[model samples]
Target: MATRLELALLSARGVGKGIRLLEYVGLVIVLAATLLAGGHEVWRMFSSGKVGISDLLLLFMYLEMVSMVETYWRMGKLPVRMPLYIAMVGIARHLMADSSYHDPWLMIAGAGAIVLLAVGVFIVRYGHLRFPYTQASEEATDRE
Candidate 1:
């Protein structure tokens, strides 16, 4: 016979498992979609006989997204810097594709954003190396 507390705990664990399953499904779907889009873009470039900045950046974004997903799948954690990289590339892609956005101020702001993301990546890497996690610390965190 299980106590009410035990039953509640079991229910919570079931819910957690369900959520994790959904997350896995969603990630797989996203990965497949990104691959399809990248394939289509590459095909378009091949057919058109010209590769431009926007197409290259789009491929970079697709690659980065796949890398992020694979890292998450393997490590069970995604670095904060990954999305920062994606955003930087995304902004660059926009700048390359959109000709009407030729305002100097906008360009400066976009450059500033990329610089900030680079700083964030440096900070995260430094912090991770400087204050490395240990197995005991991880176990203690899990208990908490």
Candidate 2:
């Protein structure tokens, strides 16, 4: 026997809980996948008995992915720069892996992409420093 407002609030709370549960499930999947991929990469390197710069870069990207997931899980929100950092590493890995076969223009474009991602990371860092989100505000947003 709840009022319409009370019913709406209850529904909202339920939805919020559902969303949070889904987020956790997604995070777990991402973490597992990243770890599996990293392990596979390590096994390949060990079996081959050779490690190249590109392989190392790929491992670094995987590490960054894991770190990004951990940061998001701990902070309840993700920084905008984590994906940019991952993208930069991915592009660098691609460039290193395919430098010999890729056309010069494609290589230049990939390098440009890395630079743009770096700029994005810089801008996000500056924004965080210059106009940081207050904890109370963040908490309020998280509650919504």
Candidate 3:
């Protein structure tokens, strides 16, 4: 029975390792694709003479995506505030690009929302850095 339990444990560890390997490979593939797409977009922007605020904002979004991928690759984890920061930037860019198309009140509201999101992202990032979760032996064993 003890041998059987050991075998099962070993099998589980093997499966976990395999899964982690696959995740790493997938992340690499995704990062490559994002880079290609961003490059293509930048080329198109340069070739076209009608560059606008929205186009610049899209580039910024692509940059954020790359940054997020790099952060994950380096730390083996994703930061929670990255997407929020991206969203805030996206909204602000949209407002800037389409200022004449929208009503004044709507534009003001959108800008206000972006400010609120930026504040929230700041708080979350600060808290995460200040109160990081440490992996002690008991917590590690509990996870196992």
Instruction: Report, for every candidate in turn, its global Cα lDDT versus the true structure.
Output: 0.90, 0.90, 0.84
Residue-level error in angstroms, candidate 3, position 10: 1.6
Per-prediction backbone clash count: 0, 0, 0
Assess the local accuracy of residue 72 in candidate 1 as a C-alpha lDDT between 0 and 100: 83
* Top TM-score hit: 2
C-alpha lDDT of candidate 2 relative to the true structure: 0.90
Q: Kindly report which residue stretches of model 3 are placed more than 4 angstroms away from their true locations once superposed.
A: 98-101, 137-144
Pairs with backbone N, CA or C atoms under 3 Å apart (clashes), candidate 2: none
Better of 2 and 3 by lDDT: 2
Evaluated at residue 10, the lDDT of candidate 2 is 97
Q: What shift in Å separates residue 42 of candidate 1 from its native position after superposition? A: 1.3
TM-score per prediction, in order, is 0.88, 0.90, 0.79
**By the TM-score metric, which is better: model 1 or model 2?**
2
Q: Put down candidate 1 lDDT per residue, 87-113, tens digits, no spaces.
A: 999998887788765898888888888
lDDT score for residue 140 of model 2: 96
After TM-score superposition, the amount by which residue 129's alpha carbon in candidate 1 deviates from its true location, in angstroms, is 1.5
